[model samples]
Every structure is written in C-alpha cells, then in structure tokens.
Target: MTDNLGRGASWQAQSSQSWLTVTASGVAGGPMQIQADPSALATNTIHYATVSVKSSDSGVSAAQPVVVALWKGTESVREVATTAAVASRYTRLLADPVRPYAYAHSNSGMVADPVRPHVQLYSNSGTIDVYNIYTGALVKSMSAPGSTLGKMLASPDGAYLYAHDLAGRQLKVFDLREGQVVATWPLDASLSVFEGGLIDLIYARPNGVGVLVVSTGQVFRASDGKLLATKIAQMPNTDRLVHGLQPFRGLSSSYLAASLDGMRVFSTDSRLYMVPNTPFYWDMDYTETNEGTLSVTKAYAANLGTTLDAGLSQAGGIAMSRDGSRVLMLSAVAGISLWSPADLSKDRMLAQDLGLQSDTLNVTPDGNIVVAGSTFGQGSPQFHVLSPDGRLLKTQVTRIAASTVKPGSTGTISALTADMAVSADGNVAIQSAIHDVDTNFGYLLTFAPIRP
Candidate 1:
C-alpha cells in the first residue's frame, strides 16, 4: 500500500490503521521523516515518496523496520529503513505503559531525510538526530552531556539548534552546519544539574527570535541564547486543579507556547503574562479558570490571557502555526484555539468544535488544520482539513477527526487515537497508528488524493 504525493498537494486522512506500508511519488519515508495522509496531500509541485510496508496495510504488528513509507501519488517511491530501529533493554526496567515521549517541530515542514528539506530529531537519548528528509537516514547525530534531550528548535537561518538535558543540568546548542557542540549553559553555570523531570520546548520567531521554554518555568532567547524570564514559569498551572494540565507519567509536552514572536507565554497554569526582559516593566495579572472566563488586568488585554487546563491538559503536546497567530493545543476539550496577538479578548474555536471528539491538534502551512479524533479511547482518529474561512473544505462531511469509524468504537464516534501533521503547503496530511499487537497496539492510517 505505497502512495505518492504532488507539490503542495494536501491529503485528507481517511483512517488510521497499523503496520501498513505507504509512500509518496518520489520521496521516500524514513525514521524522523515528515508525512501527510492521502486525503490531505499537500505538495510544492515536486517528487513524491514511495512506500513499502508488511501486509493488508492494516494495524501495526509490533515494532518493525522503518517507521513509515513515503510516496508521491501512485508509483512506488522510497523506504525509511527501520533497520536502525533498535530494541532497547531499558524497557525491561523503566518502560512507559503507553507512548512515553514524542517530537514536535517549532515550525511546520516535511519530515523527510535531512538531505531534501532538512529534518531534525530531538531524542531523550541525550542527542539530536539530523537526518535526510527524503531517506530518513541519519546525516549527523548531535550529542549532549549525560542527559536525555527535551524539546528542540532551529534558527531561521538553520545555523544553530538547541535542547535541554534534564539529567545533564545543561542547555546545549549545536551548530547545525558543523554538527558539533558550540556552547553549553549549565544550571548555576558552576556545575551540571540533573532534574529527573523537566518540561521544555523551542520556538523560532519568524523574526529570528528563537526562544526556548524550559520546564523549570524559564524562557531563554534562542537567538542570542539569553535568559529572559525565570519567574514566568510559575504563573501558569497552579498547585491546585485536580488532573489539570498534567497527564499520564512524563508523557506530555509542556503546554507553554513561547512568545519570542511576541513578548509573553500562556503557561500550563493558563494565565497569559507580559514577559518583558526588563521584568519590572509591568506587574503580571491573574485570570479566571474553567473555559468561559478571562480576567483582564492591563491596558493591553481587558480580559485576555491564556486559558487554564481546558485546552491542553496533557503535560506535553503543544505546537503553533508557522506564523504564531494560532495555537494548536492537545488534551481534554482537545481542540485548536485560534487567538491573535492583536485580539487579547475573544478566542475562536476552529474545526471539530461541533460534537467532534478531539485528542490532539496541528496547524498546516497553508492555514488548513489536521486534527486526530478517534474512538478506541483515543485510538483510531480521522484527519480533517478546515479551510481558512472557518468552513469545512472539499466534500460534505466534517473534518477528518470524525471522518472515519473510530477503532474500538461501534457507535458513530468514540475518541481520537494518534497525532497529525501537514506539508509545507498544507495540501496533504498523514495519519495512521500502531496495530496487531498484544492489545492492537500499532496501526497506520494515511490520507491521500483519490482524484484531482
């Protein structure tokens, strides 16, 4: 079941199964390679990726070679060999019940080999894997001290990239071109520090502000690598709120979207504050919780600030559009909340708001949306696209979230299963899951074009 994609062509992900082989025209799928489903195919009028998988293209059957198959439209393309996919003994001792960690790009782009479009991998294994966007082959692996790397971000110029080592007690910056360590900022700058659990993510401002938000609740300027705010991290996610923004185990990405493009952060606590480098420029204000209330405090936002646990309840799983105008949050109410730096007051709910079960969210390059909504207790989700007018694009039905029959669901719609992504053009989408395991664990679902 290999497929191919066109230039900037978007695909509407029909279903998410497991262990199936899929591909794009000339582009090949590989580990760390970006993908889009058949139904939501988006391309820039280029080559596609050819896919190669196991059987019936059904559910994923255990761990196999290569993560996905890349294709353009129809012809067989390439394969991201899973040969390098190693089995770790660490699971024997400290394994997570479900998916423990995942990756996120500060910007929206293809997940191909490092050669074609330049793909970067942020791992918990104390290193960043730079690969070929077309082949998923490792171009260079950047090493960090004795620490598992957290979220990562790259500069607009693609010159430098940064990550945090929770155990190494250091923030590492590597030269993307040189593929070597450029600078290491340790906690206290005197000695390395190790914190078992730390929350962190990177944001590259369109203006090149490149900022990194750490779990210790600190924000650092990714460009010059300057420490901006140390106290802003505490304002969001109060000690209270049972099952608030926190999720199962160490699995969720901190729900803070850096404002390097702006000047504030909407913390897990849900309060939007003015994060000025000066700090003392203005006093921070508090806000109300639950979904329908925002308390204003300054001349800027009358009642505008980020919401508490309502949007992204999961510890991790946070991302923003290329322009930073909208925030795609995951968990609970589980939908994308569209907000702008200009309007601090009202927040608009786009796509999957009307009776659609949502588990995660992602913004596409073309302003469309890719949402994963499943039924098998967040298992088999459908990928959907909502046009810029806030209306459902293409055919009649709703976006992909509820587009298909959810896994483990006999009824209309049950829950969302996995995550979603779009191409640089936002015309194509890739959706699938792991299936055929002890508990139907791995499944693959991709959305490609049926016709022009």
Candidate 2:
C-alpha cells in the first residue's frame, strides 16, 4: 500500500482464505509477506485467493485486491521412452512447433519433415527413405538422382525444405506441399571443391534465408534463386589482431543463430559476429589471396573475452531467446552467460561451475525457461532447467540402468552426448542421449508439462 497524498499512511492487510496468510498486517506501508500453505490441498488442484489492502488515508479511494494462485504438482521429470538401436550416431534433436512429435537427426544425413510432423527422412547414397517418427514404419521412399542432400533446414512457415546437395554443388529447395524440388541454386563452387561448404542456415526477413558459408555469409530469396547479399563477414581490427587473421583465412563457422524477427544473424568462429540484414551496406573492404577484395563490415563484432570450448561447439553452445531479447552463450571456462541482443553487452552471468561440463543450451519458445545438458563424464548425464534471470528451477539425471548398458570394457552406464529440444508451448521437452562406448545406440527421454 502506498499513500497518494504524500503522507505516510497506515495500511491493513487481510487474506480471503485460511490457507493464504499475510504477515505484518495493520502497519505503516512499506513491505509485507504473503505465504501459501499447500500441505492440506489436493495435488494438481489450483486454489485462488485475494489479499485485500486498505489505506488509512481517505484520499486513497478504494482497497486494493491482489490475486494469488497456487497449485501443487510433481516437480521432477520422468523418462518416457528409449529409441531403437542404430549404427549411426544421433547428431541433433528437434521438437516440432505445430505437432506433438520430436525428430532425431543422425550424422548419416537424416532429417524430419517440418511440414509433416510425423515424417522422418533419411538419405542413403542418392535414395531418400521416409518413415514414421513414432512407429519406425517406412512410409515411402524417393530418389534424388545425382544429388546427395545434407545439412537440411526448414523454412519458418514450413513450406520448403532447404538442403545442401553435396554431390551436385547446389542448394536444393524442396516444396513440401508439392512434394518435389521447386528450385535449385549453385553454391560457391570453390568451397564445394575444397569440402568447405555452407555451415548453417537462418531465416532472414522479407522472405530470405541467410546462409553461413565458410568464413563468409550470404542471403538468398526463398522463393527463387536470387542472391540478396554476399560477403557478409568481417571483424574489427583489434579482433583480427587478437585472434590472428591467418586462421580466419580458412576458418569455418562453429555455430550460427538468428533473432526471432530475422533482422540480425549471429555467427561464431573464434569470436562472435552480429551481422545486419540490411542489403548493400558495406562498412569495410578486405583483400584475400585467391578470392580478391570483397566488401564486408565490422559494425557489430563482439569479443566475449574467452575462446569458446571446441568440444561443445558441435553440441550447440549458443542460442537466442524466442523474443530476441536475450542471447545465451556457454563456454567451458565461463559456463553460461546471458547477453543483451540490443548492444551485445554482458547482461549477467546466468550460471557457472555447474559441476558437469555443459555441452548444449536451449531456450523455451516463451523465453521464460533455459535448458542446458551435459556430456557424460564420471557420472550419469544431467540436464538443468533455469529461469532467464538466473534461477535454477529443476535438475534431472538420466540414471540409465546397468541392464540397458551396451557391453563394453567397463560395463558402466554413461552417455557420450546429450541434446535437448523444447516444444513450442514450453510445456514439454525431449532429450537424446548417445551411448558412451557404442556411440551409435542411445536413449530418448521426454518431459511433459514441465510446469503445472
């Protein structure tokens, strides 16, 4: 309670329900405590109450009613199912935004159809096999002639699937509704020849897709094969000297992320680069040995003070919140730190020295929760759920049984890799854990309704 008449006013607080208690009632306005007792309440039942506050000053017109809601439910996550064993390693896990299904990608070029939630596509040589995600039943198979597609990405609207045709040296855009290749564009022939190809893809505004090439960036029109922007990577003079410009000659991007609005793209090599999506805005020009002089920029290069851990790079060490307000970066030396997207400045250290070496990081669609997973070391692999403001919410360990452990030298239950994906509604999550020794065999775990 506060006095509007600039006079120190006395206030009285009362709770509407017996289960809700208000401490320090009938006192001068400053602060008070409200507590809820849930011991007598039934599980999974929501209870509501109101805290009424009245000011002694007559100038304050009406009493204020503060509503409070409480619910009692399970706080820990439970394992749902384990996937069937395979010989190829699972490289990534993705949760469908529009459906109740999850996709597990493998190193052997397997991806899930974003438009069709239940479809899983796998590539073998030039043949593509489509299967059901839940039942492992083969639905249909198709052929791509001479093209071997890899590094697949789905458009934001789930209308097209963009993939790199490694054998053809081109980018193939497959229309999901038409079920055919709609368009194809030639990539940098030099990079394809040297096995240095596109690293990642991010959605750009105005119906464009930003492609992160080796040490360079480009944007293309998703509808056709028109190139909108090119040669988009450049670093500051100080950053070039600190990281040694020689390594950048052949540096490959370790990770790439974009804000939700698709106006900015973030890429990492030895440091971070925040590239603007505005076309034809060249800030600097630099000459390379074979590529000639190219236009670039140093407008938003950020030095994070520490070189990121290489081991965690493949496990996705960087992520942007859905609202594009927060950027989370995890380094083995610094743990996880939150950064503001507006200025690329450090907001706060979210977590550090968490015992387990975290390898993967993700944020919920609502940007309220942060999830991090660790690689197995001396103990079972674990994942943590946290708030954006740096509060730990839940911690879960895989706890694989010995019977499920593959036969090995030690016969210990451990995972070599673990990755997580949260649903669009922020209520569910799926985790994939690869076996320590087997490498190919792994387990899939699910957490539903993370909060009640």
Candidate 3:
C-alpha cells in the first residue's frame, strides 16, 4: 500500500487480539503517545511505538505509515513498548500452516451464533454478549471478524472457529474460550479456490469428517483447508448471496441445504442443483434415524401477518418449514406464498397484501410459526406474528420497528436488515436485524419464542 507520500511513520500495538489505531499526529520533536483505556488496562494492554523519520518538512498525512503485529498463544504478556513499530501478528500468521483452519463453533451446529443478537455478523465480529445461563447481563463482547471474513467452519465440539480470510488468502482459527486467534493456514487461491474472494460455509458432514467451504465455485474441507471438489453449485449468470450454515442438526450424513439469496433450496449430490422452491426454508435441525436420512416435514418461517412471496414481484426472503415440507415467503409489498416443499407449482396465499413491510424474518425450528419486524406500510417496520401457513396471528407495531439485521463481519451487528435463527431444541427462535440503526438500538434485541 503506497501513495505519493514517500517517508512515513507508523506504530503497532499488542494485545490478545491486536489492532492499530492512529495515535499521535504531526511531530513536535517531543513525546506523543496513546494511553490505554483505563478500564481495559487489566484485561487488555496499551503498547505503543514511535518512529523517527527523516522528512524534508513536518507533515504527517503527507507521509506514509507502516505497521506490523504479532499473535501468539502465551501468557497475558503485554508487549514491551518499542521505539520501532511492528505489525499485527495476523499479518505474519501465514508463515505457519497447521493452525490456520481454526474456528470458534457455537454451542449448537455450525450456524450463526444465537449468542449473537444481530443477523449479519459472523462469530468473530460477533456482537453477542454471551452470559452465564443463570445470570444474563454482560459477558465478554466477541466481535465479528473484518466484516469481510467469509467461509467459516466450527470445530466438531462447536468450541473453535475456523474462517477463511479471503482478503489475506489465509485461514484463521480462534479459541472461543479466550476469544483469541490460535492458528493460521495458507491457501492456494490459484487452485480450486474460487475467485472474487467469495467464500461461504456449509455444515460439517459425518460430524468429524469435515465441513465444506464453498468459494466462487470451489469447495474445500474446512478441517484441513484441503480442496475437496469444485463447482458443486454450478449456477451460472446470477449473483446470489447465499445464507447457509450446517443446519442446526443436519450433520449426520453428507446432506447440506444451500439457500440462494433466501430463495430457492438446492439439495446437492456433490453439487448445488435445483431441488425445489417452496413456501418455507429449513432453518433448524431434525436428525434422521439410523437409516441415514432426514425428512423434511415441518416449516420454520411464519407467514400469518407477514406478506410472503410466491411470485417475483412480491419476492423478499424464502425459507423452508423446519420439516422441509413447506415454504415461508416474506414479501416486500404483499402476502407470503405458502408453497409445498415437493412441488413449487402448488401454493397457498395468506394475509392480504399491502399494509407494511420489514426486512427480517423470524422462524421456529419445527416450522410451526414465525415473527417479523414491525413495519406497517411506509413507516419503519416493526414486529408481527404469523402462523406457518400465513395467517395474521398478531401485529406488533410498537414492539420491534427498531430490529437490527445481522452483520457479523465485525465483532458487532449494526445493520437494520433483520434475519432469524432457531436454537438447539427447536423451541427457542431468535430473530435479529441484519442491518442496524441507532434510532432502534436493540429492536427485538433477541427473541425467545413464547411456549406453545
């Protein structure tokens, strides 16, 4: 990274998870440093470095800055301040290979962390405050990764987080216990690795065999970052943002459900092929018997008061019922289209069109019901309740207009675009916003499904 500025000055800081913040500017031929947050002093540290650069004139921004860091698993050793700055350890992690595939798995399957309250963030940039099951207030805040971090796989125990760093062409693993990085791996982007730095995660198959990491068109085993197969979902001529994680419990066999932009479900026989477009999306888990097959018999996203899509115009988000028998459609302008999982041709419409709209959708694990952000017509969308078949169970305008969408790319969620996930028991349903807004600080905050 270079600019017209030739000579430069930069500093590097150290901590469990190190970061660099521009501290002092314009040199005064004197001492200029940064102080650590007094509150974080005990938990974190304040490491600073100052460099003496030879410049024709005293111009800060006119000069370039450099930084280097180090990340190693050791004591809470605060880095000794240095006169010469270093870079972030992650910058050098690639030199090693065995540790790159580490990832922090959640308490459940390799899906988004419910401990997270937002919709769009990965566990690294996790905007979650995991609390003790007994007392819920504040635990440590695990942030999302670089917002661009993609292709994550959790350890079989759901304790470690392994994410492919598309930006750096490397794999980063973190220890959830300490919320710190512990391993790194380098990839050959020139090989089965896809282009455009587009990588996403499918569930780990066989529990321990390995999780699938899909990028552009290539797939790899998340466990070893080894290339598995390429171009599984060979969909051409369309740019789709997929939302898939190992279904809460669909890891028994080699089965993985791939959702295309909240629409279309493609069940693969080693690749992403069109299976069926239905009324609901399969969000939670349902383990099959010893025969090695899980049946789709339920719905997760609700449609009652929320408008769903059977057509393109009203298109919004599409999900399968937990049982995989129905489809739950969230419409942009109208009602939801309840389609059969077996045949997209068959459909049912519930809840009249027009009234309001919201971006996020909340779904239960069993596919029995759902909830949506409150947005009655043109005003900010709020929360509403619905039956799996698209009935107006309830309207919650005053309840959740401020819902935030999930933006897990960072350690926080701030998008207002709302999304949902189910807990392990298929009982607790969590709805969150993908995008965020300050006006609605904690909309929905995190929903706990009311008992039947």
- What is the C-alpha lDDT profile of model 1 across 1-452, one tens digit per residue? 11222122222222133323333222123322334445544332223332333433323222122222223333322222111332221110000001111122211111312112334444445555443322323455556646566535444334565655555666777775577778876643332232323344545332223355554544566646565545443332122232332211111223445443334444332212111100101122221234112121231221322344223322223455555665444433444445454443335655445323332344554655545444332234444556654576532111222223244522222111333333323333322222222233222222232111
When summed lDDT is taken over every stretch of 10 residues in candidate 3, the lowest stretch is 88-97
Candidate 1 lands at a TM-score of: 0.50
TM-score of 2: 0.58
Clashes of each: 124, 0, 98
lDDT of 3 by residue, 1-452 (tens): 11123333332222322233334344333333433233322322212222322333434332322222122222432111111111211110000011111112121112333222111123333222332111112234445456335444444333455565655566666665566666665554554334323333454332213334443333445445554544333322222222331211111111233332222332211212221222222322222245222222232321222121223233344455665665555554555555555444436665544333332344554454444443443343344556666666654322222212223322222212134333332333333322233433332223333344
What's the lDDT for all of these models?
0.36, 0.49, 0.34
TM-scores of the candidates in the order shown: 0.50, 0.58, 0.43
On lDDT, the stronger of 1 and 2 is 2
Q: Model 2: runs farther than 4 Å from truth?
A: 1-84, 108-150, 178-181, 192-198, 206-216, 235-251, 270-299, 303-316, 355-359, 368-372, 375-379, 398-420, 431-452
lDDT for model 3, on a 0 to 1 scale? 0.34
